[model samples]
Every structure is written in structure tokens, then in C-alpha cells.
Target: MAKYSEKASEKVEESMHETKEGKLKSGSGKKVTSKKQAIAIGLSEARKEGAKVPKKKD
Candidate 1:
């Protein structure tokens, strides 16, 4: 199972909302975007805050 800190989870949730509200766009000029990117963004912020977030697998 993928483990994520509370902050990371929150970020992902917000990002998901943005996508749902049509506020975010993909690089391919599409409305559909990867949720992983949102998760990654969240994890990055969590890491900056020293939150306990798991490293992303390459």
C-alpha cells in the first residue's frame, strides 16, 4: 500500500478538487491529468516541511 503523510493527502485532495473543477490542465492540452502528479506535488511539499512521507519509486 502507498503510504502518505496527512499533509500529502491533503494536497492530493485539493489537487483532485482543482482537476474536478476544471482548474487544472494537462501538458497535452487535455483536462485529464495524472493523480500521481498531485501526489508527487503533495509529497514534495511534505518533504519540505519534514513530514513523514515515503519516497516515490522511480
Candidate 2:
């Protein structure tokens, strides 16, 4: 199993929450409707924040 930092997990959780509440949006300002997409957004943010997240796959 891959290890994600606490901060990364927290960001993921927050994004998931936003998705559940119908408040998550994509870069184009469209409402996010997929759980996977939400997770991706969270991870991307964590990466920007310098969290212990793995590098994205090509």
C-alpha cells in the first residue's frame, strides 16, 4: 500500500466532503460529480502544498 501523509489525507477528506455537499468544482468551474475526480483534486492540492504525496503517474 502506498503511504499518504496526514495532511494529504486531510485534504482528500475535505474535497470528498465538498463533493458530497455538491460544492466541489473543476478548473473550468464545472461542478465535480465524480468521487475519483475529487480525490485527484485533493491530491493535486496536497502536492502544491508540499505534502508527502507521491509523484503523479505519467
Candidate 3:
């Protein structure tokens, strides 16, 4: 099992909401439509904030 900090979890939740509302966008200026992409964005944001998120799997 992987462990995520509370802050990271909250960021994921926030990103999910933005995705559902059609407000989330990718680095290429494309609107995000996939749930997996949204989650990735959230984790990326959490990482930027120094949240305790595990490194991406290869």
C-alpha cells in the first residue's frame, strides 16, 4: 500500500473537483478530461507544495 499525506490527499480532492467542473487544464493548455490525468495533476501540485507524496512509479 502507498501512503499519502493529508495535504496531498486534500490537493487530489481539490483537483478532482476542478476536473469535474471542467476547469482543470494541462501544461499544454488542453482541458483535462481523464480522471487519471486529474489525479496526476493533483499529485504534481502536492509535490510542488512539498507535501508527503510518494515518488512516481516507473
Highest TM-score scorer = 2
Candidate 3 lDDT, 1-58, residue by residue in tens: 8899999999999999999999999999999999999999999999999999999989
lDDT of 2: 0.97
Angstrom error of the Cα, residue 7, model 1: value is 1.0
Off by over 4 Å in 3: none
TM-score of each: 0.57, 0.97, 0.95
lDDT of 1 at 30: 69
Model 2 CA lDDT for position 19: 98
lDDT per residue as tens, model 2, 1-58: 7799999999999999999999999999999999999999999999999999998989
Evaluated against the true structure, the overall lDDT of model 3 is: 0.97
Cα lDDT, model 3, residue 56: 91
Worst 10 residues of 3 by lDDT: 1-10
Whole-model Cα lDDT of every candidate shown, in order: 0.69, 0.97, 0.97
Candidate 1 accuracy as lDDT: 0.69
Tens-digit per-residue lDDT, 15-56, candidate 1: 778776777655566664667765565567677788778776
Top candidate on lDDT is: 2
Identify the superior model by TM-score, candidate 1 or candidate 2. 2
Query: Order of candidates by lDDT, top first?
Result: 2, 3, 1
lDDT of 3 at 6: 99
